[model samples]
Target: MDLKNLFNVNGKVVLVTGGSRGIGEMIATGFVSGGAKVYITSRSADACDKVAKELNARGPGQCVPIPADLQSVDEIKRLVAEISKQDSHLDVLVNNAGANWNGSFHDYPDEAFDKVISLNLKRIFTLSQACLPLLSAKASNANPSSVINIGSIDGIRVPPQDTYAYSASKAGLHHLTRHMAGKLGGDGILVNAIAPGAFQSKMMKATLDAFGDIIKSKIPVRRIGSPEDIAGTCIYLASRAGQYTNGAVITVDGGAAVSANL
Candidate 1:
């Protein structure tokens, strides 16, 4: 393959949770557009099925939709089981399914905090464990599998919002990525986290809309992250170019982390 082809994700099997929309959809689109066979999942069956069809038309690649509620370990296991029925091995697993909640620190409910942690942090552990067999089936020195977690910049710095649980969970996930990378490296599986700043997605639409100019002013790039920014980062992580990269937390904020701290 040529040097430029090192970045290609073609012929790989990728699974992206919460792939119906937002950052998850962007990642799936990039992989599929590059010719990787992708499997997308979400709580909404209609949304999953819809994106699958749309992505299939994008390139030589194909997409499969697996509608699943990843709120618990059982559901995560089921999602993996469903995947096993289609392919023997998975080249990439993107833990992108998550939720955010906000409340006054003094009044944050226990269940609300638990809910964010459970979904954002706990389920990733379960899903990764469940996908181990598939990940290892064809893993090797030349072609290792990858576990890419979708983290947020909120984890790195305190945000203006009162989303205590969301921040804590993402911070935990970043550390967990390093921990998993160390443990899974021997198995030829890389682990990494992407800490994205403001982005143009439904999740950040309201925030950007309300504070578009302000957010731009804070970011050195004077703009929000695009689908390419997030997708390209992940493509590098899952492709041959990233085979030696492991246990890294890549911050795709365009210098927002620096400006925001100032």
Candidate 2:
């Protein structure tokens, strides 16, 4: 295989959940640019359709949007069935749809904790289970099917902020990625995760506003994350370029996790 083709995703079929905006949108764009036919999903059909149209206008790659709530298992089942009909073999699955809520531990409601875990942890497992058959059917070492879970920096190191439930859920997800990787490696389905730091998304902007330049100055890279930071890592994992990488949590943080507070 040509060196260039190692990073290429031509003719591959990928599915990305919560791919309408933020990090998810960047990943979708990267796959499309790499020549993969991608299908993206979110709870909002209108948002998904709009992004799909925008991405399709960019290049030769095609993108389809299917609206489904990742928080619901039934919705995932139906969504997977529809996708199976579109492609008998799926090349990649990006489980990026997740939610987090910040609250004081003493007053955190049970509903809030459950909500974060349900979508972040439980839904990820469900989606993987649903997509396994398709991934296995298309498995190959050179371009093996992949599962990329979007985790958080909070999971790896202690959270600077106090999103108790969010931190716990992501910590669990980090472990889950390793567990899944071991169980699925023999099946030719590579499983991995990307734990990102502060990014300029709707979710992180709020934190940025509160912390300002102090947040950026504290990081080793001295800047926040960009779409490319996420998109590049995600595409590499999904393509043949990352064939040997599995069961790893690639941290895309700007060295925030390693910096000593003292």
List, residue by residue over 91-187, the lDDT tens digit for candidate 1. Answer: 9999999998878989999999999999899999889999999999999878899999999999999889999999999999999999999999889
User: How many collisions per candidate?
Assistant: 0, 0
Where is model 1 poorest over a 10-residue stretch in terms of lDDT?
199-208
lDDT of 1: 0.92
Return the clash pairs for model 2, or none: none
State TM-scores per candidate: 0.97, 0.96
* Deviation in Å, model 2, residue 181 alpha carbon: 0.6
9, model 1: CA deviation in Å?
A: 0.6
lDDT of 2 by residue, 1-262 (tens): 6686777788889999889988899899988987889999999999999999999999678999999988888999999999988889999999988888888767988998899999999889999998888999979665579999999989987886768888888899999999999999888899999999988876777889999599899899899998889989988898778989999999998899888464
